[model samples]
Target: MTHRWLHLRLAAPLVAFGDVAIDHVGPTRDFPAASALTGLLANALGLRREETSAHQALQDRLVFGAMVIRPGRLLTDIQNAKLEKKDCGWTTWGQPDVRTGDTYDSPHRRRRDYLADHDCRVVLRLHDLPEGPDLDRLAEVLDRPARPLFIGRKGCLPSAQLFAGWLEGENALEALKAIGLPGRAFWPAEEGGGTVRDISDMRNWRTGLHGGHRRVSEGEIA
Candidate 1:
């Protein structure tokens, strides 16, 4: 039995609209990508650490979900792809709604159009391994960076589990075997990892791009 490790990448932080509200709000109150990530991980993986400790650790390490989106369509196209039952290679990780709010500026209008009604945005970005998924194609079509970070520092849950699956086409189990995770252990472990903690605790809401937000200045993640 092999266990598989799926690494989800998350952007920095930003504001997000949610039914729940935080104590005080500000540009800094933008979603705490790190904090939310920790909650998600704890819920997904069912870590043994205390809630507070896990939250702090996940935040400090800056771990979160990842998605590969088409370039100019980072906002709109990705959403459409997802809406159309197409996979953006998104994980069960956190993402904000990009259709609302007045805080984003992109060179491309398609992205603006898609995000026009959503209020959530990405902040920082985490890289994914090439073999992990082909966000490259999505990036190429958009003629922009393949991977994009959420700029809004916020959080919302849409029950979007399109990315979660029992398998990843073509016996990913074989890949896990090659990687040394026992096959029998793979599925259960992955499910456990994805459902480690309280989903609500992972809520985040922060928007507004600060000078710190950055795209892939280096070459794409081949």
Candidate 2:
């Protein structure tokens, strides 16, 4: 079955594909997460943080696969900051996020992982739901986003326009192969054969937590 897919070029000097965090260590995965892509699209559509239902709905509708065009080096960033009861931080929405906890005497510290000089390609298509935005609407908004778009985090901005073009294939894996870029790829396990692995990437937007696992096939795609 031939299906049309939206192509995205996710290239950046520093990109962070989020992984399940423990303590002060925030790690990144080699490929983009389904929740991350869902957030990216929702942000392009100018959806606000309060719209949990919309975010959840969007995530449920996404079906995507990613290819690593450039296997970049891993970079770790050590960060520390001291905060008072009245300290506030700036957010992506251009507003101040006030601290609402007891003052801390010591500086808060954490380590974040990122991919330096990384480049990835993604092919995405929405599930055939009766409601919600379609491929055309998503492409249109990405071209002229309601808000500034970022690759993974607000600090990791894309170097080029994300809308890479469109292609048709039987599934996400075949669509990536159609691009002719050789690299490691990940796609739905049911779509084809590869090393089947369970990945925990989906998020429950309403609860603001990462839960559940999806099976995917990981292998080299030439």
Candidate 3:
């Protein structure tokens, strides 16, 4: 059977390929992770977390590849957020006369790192088309996603459309490179610019592969 590929352009003014946040500092990855990308697809298809079958099928069948076209600048932001108190301590909304300050703090300060002015090309090959939206079906869904799609956070909206186009080919990396939209994204000397690196090992976030790590390359696409 001829292989098929799902191509996507994740463009956003302020995108965050979320890195695990610790000690009030949340850093973002240079590129999107397998888990996060899969989750976004799942979200687009309106698949709930309770549906494990669809999620697992997607993870097992898909071979993920990505090119950081325009490597965005990294910026960290510190802000204070007001969180509603879970208990009765924060009854300011319901009971204006009651005192809630003693119970819970209103705002918490945290630092978040983000990738600004970024555009990336993500391609996926479906080795196995499961019961539901395999890959093509998923792509169709992306064209008119059931829910609004965001980069990492809900607020970080995509500047460009996610569904760029599709391709039919056996080579995942070559197809990605051919379709890759190159730009002047930032890349240090250590990290090769315009080289497509395999990020399968670092796919799942719950399985402890968060901190923007890509391991075991199948060689660079160059």
For each candidate, what is the lDDT?
A: 0.28, 0.92, 0.68
Estimate, for each residue in 9-128, the C-alpha lDDT of model 3 and write its tens digit: 898989888765578887888767666777788889998876766666676565766668777999888899664544334333576444355433567888888888988777776665
Arranged by TM-score, best first: 2, 3, 1
Model 2: lDDT to the true structure: 0.92
Among all windows of 10 consecutive residues in model 2, the one with the lowest summed lDDT is 86-95
lDDT of 3 at 159: 89
What lDDT tens digits, residue by residue, belong to model 1 across residues 58-132?
Answer: 444332222222121122121212232222334546863344333334322212112222222222222334322
Best by TM-score: 2
The candidate scoring highest on lDDT is 2
lDDT winner, 2 or 3: 2
- For model 3, the run of ten residues with the poorest summed lDDT: 183-192
